[model samples]
Target: MSDKITFTLHELVSELDAQADELLKARHGITGSQFIALATLADVEPTDITDLARCLGVTKAAVSKRVPSLVKAGWVTTTHPPGQGRRVLLELTDSARDLVERAGRDLDEQFAALVDHPDASGIDLSALNDHLNTLTAIFRQKGPRA
Candidate 1:
């Protein structure tokens, strides 16, 4: 690929991420990483550090490092799994559940607003989703080693 094309994509992604971070920070007073972790926990069953890392596309060590901050905030509770040696299962505190719900609602509204473009044309969302599914399958098979 040409350098210009690659740089354009990178710039676009960086701009998108920066905008998203600003929105979440202004609305929830939380960083995007924290929002992602809370949202993942809200949607999935209580998960261990390893599971959370996979869900967030981060490393287990990174998740482990964040656990203490969450614990201090009373937003998460940890439990040691028997026979798992040192694995800690993370669960959202009840208060965290409420926060997560509120944040999720806000994010949904924000995203809906962005996608509610009056000039949007010829955008088949279902087809886009199907294409994403194909891409995901290809990536899975390639195993990040391609």
Candidate 2:
């Protein structure tokens, strides 16, 4: 692709991410980061903040900050796992499952629509995800700047 096309791809991703953050806040009263933490917990095995950070390819501090918001939103609860030596186990609440399911459907619909639209039709969904994964890996290896 040309330089302009590649730049458009990057720009589109960033735009979509901002829009997603707004959508989450409007519909769920939570930020994209918080929703992501909850979604990870809902899908992944019961885990602590550290494991969740690793799973999301984000930092522990990032996940830690979101945990309190999720807890306040009634989407999560944290506790000490049995014999885990103070390891804090996180659980998704019943409300969280409902919220995730509802938001998941909305997000899925929004994504499908975006991908199907003429502006985004050139990119394959799987290819986009693969490229995003590569970007995530690179970021993890190098880390982000302040």
Candidate 3:
């Protein structure tokens, strides 16, 4: 490859995301973004749209847009707490929890296979993951460039 490290990294990220979306859609009938949202909800305590958006690094509008579809699909349910007029609490349904568990296992297996492939021999995946985590932290700290 040429010395365009950032370009290569961008391409890799895009391709990986595309592939993941495709796999998730085919296997679970959910988009990658939806799956991510569901996973986040599973991890965190019950929260409203704004807090969920913050956890997902997205806008409130983005999370709001997805909520209806998730509810309609039976993956999520929203409820307004007593006296909490406009604030809606979001939670994953039992089916969504099941889907998340299955998808997590499938993705984990796929990741293991990818890293264990012959072509990936000699790669220190743990160190690579640590470096990627560090890079992600730096990017989050710096925010996005103009």
Instruction: Report clashes for each candidate as comma-separated counts.
Output: 0, 0, 0
Q: How far is each candidate from the true structure, as Cα RMSD in Å?
A: 3.2, 3.9, 2.2
**Winning model by lDDT:** 3
Predicted structure with the largest TM-score when compared to the true one: 3
- lDDT value for candidate 1? 0.81
Question: lDDT per residue, candidate 2, 6-68, as tens digits?
Answer: 688888778877887888889867677677777888877479988999888899988888788
State the lDDT of candidate 3 residue by residue for 1-146, as single tens digits. 44798988988778777888988999989898888999999988489999999999999999999899999999998999999889999999999999999998887678777989898998887788899999989989998899
Residue 62 in candidate 3, Cα distance off native in Å: 1.8
lDDT of each: 0.81, 0.81, 0.89
All candidates in order of TM-score, best leading: 3, 1, 2
Q: Mark the regions of model 2 whose C-alpha exceeds 4 Å error after superposition.
A: 1-9, 119-146
Pairs in steric clash, model 1? none
* TM-score per candidate: 0.76, 0.73, 0.83
lDDT of 1 by residue, 1-146 (tens): 33695687678567656776787789878777787898898777588999988988999999999999999989999999889898888999998898888877776576556656876555665676698689878977888662
